[model samples]
Target: MDKAYRFEGTYLQWLKEELTGWDRFPWALFGFGVGFQLAILLLNPINWIAVVSFIGIFFGMWCTVAMGAGGYDSEGNRVSSHAINGLLGSISVIAYVIINVSAGHYWSVLDQLVFLFLIDLPLLKNWRTWSGKSTEIKGLTKMGWLYVIVAILAAWFVLYYVGIYLHDTNPLWDALALAIGGTASWLCFRQYSTTYTLWLISDFVNVLLWFTALKDGYSQAALPMLAMTLFYTATAIVGKINWRPNKVQ
Candidate 1:
């Protein structure tokens, strides 16, 4: 077999062996998320889109926590929970976009669109890993740092212009959240452990973003999103610990 295949096989074997020990799932966190989403659903039983978004949000949150805490499948294979999270997150954001569009909140639609791109990166990375391609986590190279800088600058400029000039929304918070979160997503796609650090920063900014939106009566949907960011912030801390440089491939 080719060297790439051999390497991937070795990696999978290592993961399987590593997961053979006492690896317990975080059922408490999962239960809490389920309860939270169910409460939202009970309150908005007629809003099917909200129901769909809640389903997606719950799975996305669960998978993100699982990934941070080192998840394994029934067969002991390391589960690419980010892939699942990304897919469900995309669905959730799409539903949010529709909701925003119907409410004439074009800026919120734009925000959700950007979020879709961020989450989809992990799905792309997972596809590469599953296709016998290299998806090894590594430290950022100089070029990678440059790319991040450029991306953040570009994202900030556009988000600032759109959010400030066109909408009455919190522009700075939106810009910061998207810029940092986009960087984190790109780093994640490149398989860098440092993505967790960036994600931690982004998650805090996102909490502020949605919290302010809810406070200003932007959308009642912001409540669940705010809670989601808080959960993500906690998981990002877990990911930082679990995906430290020494532990990464």
Candidate 2:
């Protein structure tokens, strides 16, 4: 068996292995997007803008992670992951606008979870398995570590944002959390120790958020978020148990 490369200064190698096999990655954006739309449909808030924005950003990140795993075109050229990410990002903007128009409440905890684990987690797990290739992903890079810190801070900040700012109902902080979370998630995929551990920590944070949301009487918004959180937890478990070096050629 090939030795698993230690997680030290190996981002370049990981990037290479990750960039290959672009043509056949199964991205799970469609599922998450669908879930978000349904959440909005069911939550049925008089003001739907905030909820839609939240869902849109969440799913957009979903697109970022799924696409980051890789893709290719008919001619076999590498399809730009950036392009896919950009397109999804644009959709998120439109969703944000819709949220402003709807002026609905933020997504509930359970709703976030459903979108995450149910819709997004499987895609990530499948990507890891299907890729079957593991390269050394170091977590020490300045940007990499920044992502980790930012992800945690983002989660924490959103909670505080919800609690402290009674009038600023824009949900911008939560959007920032999702954005940072998505970036951090991709960075996590590039490494090992930080990858699994950070995800577990993030899952815990989500659970905490669920409690907070529920206690505050936002139970209607908690379902999808909680679902996604659980899915993320499951992904962390699978990753830790099954992760190995060079499983894919």
Candidate 3:
């Protein structure tokens, strides 16, 4: 077979495997996200933008849960869920940015835009590998570690600067969440199981961030986001367990 045909076949096969097996679906996580959104909607004034944001967050939750359940393949590489996660997460960030901007929450818009870039970077950087055109799975090298450090530092500095200069509600929480979360994304792209640990840390910070926002009346739409971050924390634990490396005989 020609290289193009071979690549197509492999990609199709991977998709087939990923899409089938309904029993493997993370129904509990999905249900929690849906139920939480609905419950919050009942309590809050119906804002169309908030509804759209909820939808985006739901998809993002789906991606996270799916990645946790799918885990890695036999060769110690992540399943194709990483690519799908990136796509869904990008959509989620766009929704967040739209809502924040419409509400004149420029700080949140900045934060979401940075997150969108982080989520999409891997897809752009490793299209061939993620698309199954290449089966190469990268190990965390010195360069990868360096990348993570740089990302964290950059995220912190930017968020801190904005928080101090622009009077953001909670710059420290934003900076910590994104710094760790961005590192997690980088580790995830490299298929490192340790990504879940960083995710756990990030999610906790996010939960606190949103909780503070809701309590302080920074945003009336913070309830759903707070709930979403709580679920994210749960999924991080699940991902950590599911992504555990198999023991050597």
Candidate 4:
């Protein structure tokens, strides 16, 4: 009886340790962010979704910073997997704003700018670390710089739309912004093998939808974007499961 009891206790302890590292907070935050962004996409009568998006974005960014600060794999590869993941997801929302704006449906440029400043500006302070020797601290490198450029273009795309919507200006800025952002996102896909690359691939698809919004309308692009996001969610799940840190012997 004593031997059986000891074996059961050992198994429980092992189970607890094994499950402890399965961080889910980042995923939850990202999921909510995506949902908020997608829900705001409208065509019948354009309305402000920024209020809800603001909440989602805040929580999402919080999760990213928290996870990046401590989430490491068994290999000691500090990729800030969760934080990067949230960043990727959040960028998609920013992408959508750009596309809509470019298509001439500007709503809240100030809000968008504030959101970007809050979530991304602090990251610039850590730029030097990307070149450092530490594997955990230096994951961004050139690829990270490219990612930042893409993010900027995306934000600019939104502002460009604001100009068009408010001032009735026909801007050639959309083409330029999309070209640069797409190229950077493509580079990210080429360089990384982790979930980060997959996120970029997903963003590439969103870029296509953005173009369609420019040509056809936001509704046309938005419906398809929603469907694609479902795939994005699935990909995130697959990545989370397969990329679990390989256990150390």
Candidate 5:
């Protein structure tokens, strides 16, 4: 296998080998995301808060495309794709925490904490498999299922209270978002096609989450949040179609 790096030839090789054959969907979506978010930031204003929000949104869009590109199918494949998903998701999470703290969306931070392990642990374990360095995944599916249950429970029981403790009235939505997001991320990590279906649900909740922020007068952060909402919708829908079960592979 070619060594993976950002240097001239190596970067191109990794792209061709690991991220090719998914059609031009990821490229187009990535272009749209960067252009749209940059336009939003440029046309409006420039401040530290705005910069952080844009950064968060950029990574958010990246994660969306990565998840779609690395989508899992119901036919017990795509775990390789899911590896990329978790890698990108981890970056998105860190950027998102910055966005949340900067925008005073503390509740979202708590939710991220709850799901952190779900993303990172899988990324570490699955990267080798995706890179063709290993082929052993004994009990991975069963362990993933356990994570699903534990994640949702943690999202609902623990993160739910965090929202309440923060005096947020929308704790229910927060909890549900975490539950869905956590499970959806897990499914992607496990290379399950149903992950996209779950992401659609989470995407809707994410829209609501930002809508709440916009409604609460965090306008500086709202516009980009709304833009991300639309991008995520497209990603989730396309992801489902791109790697569906029984589809021609």
Candidate 6:
């Protein structure tokens, strides 16, 4: 807690910690996830928005890791509060959607725009400890249901615009992914353990979304999402296995 998970540690050390299961938060796996995205971005013929999304995801993931490791109470209960990560990540997704829509890549990003707007709640709260660290992670709260409602509305909106801006023939799955993905993101900001579970479902949908894009000639764009999906699957598994109640609670 004093050092915010000591993010400054050497790569070898981080790797060793992950391999040996010495680190509680799976920093090594998360780090690998980031690296995978970075590689895909570098190798692909991507635009600036893609790069921006990468930066957003990079900063968001690392910030979440830091915030998670940084926050705690006197009894050592892990804090669930955060702001910057949620903001950065949502913005990243927005940029991704905008670029994709403008480029006519697919309706996935366009469809996902609805949920992205709600992700700002975490930033609005800016929950932190008196020491300027994170606070204990709490349950889904009433907000979880709100996310569900928002997702549903977003899904409907996606379907409504399908014929207008989208031509996917069958965008049902993509819309489902966006609905769930947006909720999953919101859940993560709320520090709900269930976020990983929701994300697992979302990630699977994303796999389909990107794969569909690849089928439609967006290979470079799809690759990163695919790579991220694989890593997301891994992280979801790890997160669920390691989840626990607040130490203080």
Question: Quick one: ranking by TM-score, best first?
Answer: 3, 5, 1, 6, 2, 4
Model 5 C-alpha lDDT per residue in residues 1-249, reported as the tens digit of each score: 113512234433544444544446677888988899999999987998788778777766776676556433333344323345555566667777877666566666765764567665565454543432112222234566577667777767886787788876567666777778767756554546667777788888878877887887754777788789779899888777655544211
Candidate scoring better on lDDT of 5 and 6: 5
Candidate 2 per-residue lDDT, tens place, 165-187, comes to 64433344343434344444554
TM-score of each: 0.70, 0.42, 0.73, 0.29, 0.72, 0.60
Which pairs clash (backbone N, Cα, C closer than 3 Å) in model 6?
79-135, 79-136, 79-137, 80-136, 80-137
Candidate 5 error regions (>4 Å): 1-16, 70-82, 113-116, 124-126, 131-162, 246-249
Worst 10 residues of 4 by lDDT: 129-138
Model 6, stretches more than 4 Å misplaced?
Answer: 1-25, 46-50, 63-76, 80-83, 102-116, 129-165, 168-170, 185-192, 241-249
**Residue 212 lDDT in candidate 6:** 74
lDDT agreement with native, every candidate: 0.62, 0.45, 0.64, 0.40, 0.64, 0.54
Which tens-of-lDDT digit does each residue in 65-162 have in candidate 1? 64466555444444323344455566567666665554344555665676567555445455324311113446666676788778878888887887
Highest TM-score against the true fold, candidate: 3
lDDT accuracy of residue 145 in candidate 6: 58
Ranking 2 against 6 by TM-score, winner: 6
Question: Which run of 10 residues does model 1 get worst, by summed lDDT?
Answer: 127-136
Expressed as tens digits, the lDDT of each residue in 107-224 for candidate 6 is 4565445445544544433323112233343445467657766776776576647734556433666666666766666665445666667767777877776677667764445566
Report the error of model 4 at residue 107, Å. 15
Number of clashes in every candidate structure? 0, 38, 0, 1, 0, 5
